[model samples]
Target chain A: MSAQDTVLVVGAGPAGLSAAATIASMGKKAVIVEKEDVLGGAPIISGYAKLVPSGEWAKDAIGRMVSRVEGDGNVSIHKSTKVTQVAGEAGNFTATLSNGDKLDAGAIVLGTGFTHFDSINKPEWGFGTYEDVLTTTQMEQMVGTGQIRCPSDGRVPERVAILLCVGSRDRQIGREWCSKICCTVSTNLAMEIKEISPSTDVFIYYMDIRTFGLYEDKFYWKSQEEYKTKFVKARIAEVTKSPDGRLLVKGEDTLVKRPIVIPMDLVVHAIGMDPNALNPEIAKTFGIGLEKHGFIDRAEQYTNSQGTTRKGIYVCGSATGPETIDDSIAQGQAAGSRAVADLYGQQKVAS
Target chain B: MAIHEKTLIDPDRILQHDHLVVDGVDVSGSWNTMITPRTLTDYEEHFEEIIQSYSGGENVHRCWQCGSCTNSCTMYAQNVDFNPRYWIYLIRLGLKAELMKDKDIIWQCVSCNKCTNICPKDVRPEGVMKATAHWLEDNGLTPKTLSTHFDEEFTHQCIEFGRIEDTEVMVGFFKRSGQPLVQAWIVEFGKRLTKRLPLGQLAKMGMNVVFRPKTKSWGKTGEVLAEYVKAQKEAAHHG
Candidate 1:
């Protein structure tokens, strides 16, 4: 195939894998460069428990996507590599990989995804201070292992408190946007916790239960109705230790109109998403603009939804903003189609 | 929190045609109830501040009405109309007329603190309940409730003797509320208590009731507390 027939896909997450698969299916060559040694992105890398909407294990679900791209002959995979530089215009471009490999591509699809908000920034919530306080990711790992025990000691937690919006929607932390998935994920985790240890009572403290779309009844209501997980409308102010060695979640129970300090065996922070840490460097390397929030800037959403500020360069998934894995895959496919069409359109004009 | 509750819709506004046919379609009873749209104009702009002027209602302005208070409410479980979230919404919107609709039940808060304990915004809905109930009585919209009368009697005992004389407090409550002291429930309760108690303990209780117990160190403490309470009440009312 000519250089103009190849599409360079960045990152090997759900979005990137789908993008490459879509490009290959469209009868075009796809060069996928993933910085991580392994593929499947956050879900597989982070070892997420079970995906929301579908209770399938992250490994099994995202693994299928990985195998599809890996099995495709039209796609060339480069692991532990970065696209260091992009030179030339749209429909004909050259990309330099970190592994000293050079690639000629017609268009690029960025599916770099996002970084899970680190709970250490919000010190008062006690991620680092208390051994029992864990992030949702860490809790998911425990769920993946099918072991629900307090990290402080090898004891089954009697009560687990899942605090939502730990990193998102907090103006104090400067992360004003909703992370979008945490509410559903937290509810899913709550049910998982109840399932693993039926005796353990799980309480999810949320500002607003934004299990949007179909996820509302499936995750939120199901967790409450089926699993018997309690949903509290209190955003915890602080997570402290009680005299009895149990974690203390301090907050005003707005319903009861009283400041309450509830003791828990485990406290989980439903950490939000932040723009991928490598976004600035990626934007600079790809000659793309970054939005004010630091996600890749979309040129115009109306006509070209996947088009980044730079023509022939498209952005999808959490690299643009906080997006679900399923939506990101759809966006990846959309970006792939856009890249292929733009390249073919250029060739049609040239011919 | 649900912004629009079923209770907010007045029964009068809901018109259901028993038998009707419209445009070749037969629209029957209850399926299609036409609710007249309510247009509110008499909103007190400073209603939130007015509620804030009362104790416990100070944080009434902080309510985002997430319904956590109502969801975990002890009173709401008993009566759906006892919705703290909806009342808070009305208070915030300065819907005085709408609020008056639920004035009778507002004083029925069991003080369970469930709503306050679960509220995300620290909108102490329990305190708001107490404040709202007190506001109603202070404005003469509601008569002093039996609960308020009981509270006054209990407070009177505490101030006079630095202790609660349960029998005196109950008698005082009945007197203030214009209820007969020899109620059937009180008689049944006395019979149960006598069955559970020994003769010696019963005699001691009778002696204590006859001669009201007083704390020895309560010298002038009652007067100080009474004066402080008076001043605080005056400030809260007028300030």
Candidate 2:
């Protein structure tokens, strides 16, 4: 494998696109395959400003990467295409694409990100049963549309309840792993909703408030002090529909050991993320391995987060594990450098 | 709300003793020596053997006693003492007497299958509940109210008719339970008036339940079920 060798990257999200841009910058032929008609994956669907380290807009960061990759002649992007079949050995594999086209690659990187956990599985959350109850994704769309009205009545909600950990940290539902990002995302949404509608009451039911790193003080102060969002430390037991079309949320205040039922005009389930549904298919097709929890298993945590068990194949971002945008970008760059090192037989570039 | 006064154990004093006795029973075991050993060794042994017999029951030993299953149970949503996880734990720990005390809770399951679906490790908590119910029936530990009327009536109806006739089953159930038989007719009449009778929607309810078809080989199926139970008992004894 050389600089002229083509490296195929699956997915066009931050991780895949970052890898493509990095590879092209290093003068390698990089090809990106995206299943969606447009790029940006969940971010576009979410319609939120990405949280950068410097509090900069995520679009600006993503726009820079997209320009670099698209401007480079070595990088070829294939939208509305999926890799149907992967065959051959490491360093000389063939990917049979969806359009009956085949591409030969010296190295491959899997960055097919995670899918949102289906909140309806937790039926007690009243996700599908109540029209007023929406998912975090749906809430984002509402905010994007510049109105936060109850889906049932098309009226501005006077009382809103956001339930955290709908599909995360719940052993009874079998998803014990912490989704890590939902806390900050929910807290941020709560603040935004309050800023838009100051009189609207927002209550967040959470098992625990996990605001890790620099976002910790910001999340805590904003929700607790600034926005005055009522934080209740309890896991919701059930969400029922009231005769008036409001959602009746029931849960025990763990500290008080007493049940509390609050009626709200609207409810939001901050659902977690699971490994992409295509993870198993990709693992079998590429001879990679999956963890017990179904995410692609990295070879080692410390030294090989990007590298999988198979040689010449690297995995990064949410495909390997749950991560924020900052972590995904860093891992993407590292994976690109690692793939380059594997091809060139030297670690010249600082990842 | 009023807080009731009760005898309080000194936490410091209890920590000093390696073993504690509750009502003349030894509490010392592999993990918690402070609590009384409510489970018997023989019962624990048999429960483990039965669990090991089923592929789905293999995760029974992985219970960390977190009480998450019991806390999240839909049955417990209605009844406070109907803790399925605790019952399963009792079975694992060989607390047969404690398990037998809550036999009614075993059948109270609506089979919502929510517990198994939400189990973090794919523990199949519902299967454990079913296994416990089956174990109670095999051991004859089911309460008289549950076994004498409900179980006997259901078993008799299935064995004799191959399928249960709702009206006949209700009448038989009421008669055996010392209730009046005419009550069943009143209920049936009320159901018929509301167009809720099963026989009325025979075509929609599926052919098996609507027609009440007799099993061609009822005897064979009964024999197979009996043999399976006997084999399980033998294995439990050896185990």
What are the candidates' C-alpha RMSDs? 20.7, 26.3
Question: Which residue pairs clash within candidate 2?
Answer: A172-B118, A173-B118, A174-B118, A174-B119, A174-B120, B39-B94, B39-B95, B40-B94, B44-B94
By summed lDDT, the worst window of 10 consecutive residues in model 2 chain A runs over: A49-58
Task: Score candidate 2 by DockQ.
Answer: 0.01
- Per-residue error for A159 in candidate 2, Å, reads 1.8
> Is model 2 an incorrect, acceptable, medium or high docking prediction?
incorrect
TM-score of 2: 0.58
Model 1 Cα RMSD, 1 decimal = 20.7
Model 2 C-alpha lDDT per residue in residues A118-149, reported as the tens digit of each score: 98799888888888889888887777666778
C-alpha-based local distance difference test score of model 2: 0.73
| lDDT of every predicted structure (CA atoms) | 0.86, 0.73
RMSD of 2: 26.3
Using lDDT as the measure, which candidate wins?
Answer: 1
Off by over 4 Å in 1: A346-351, B1-239
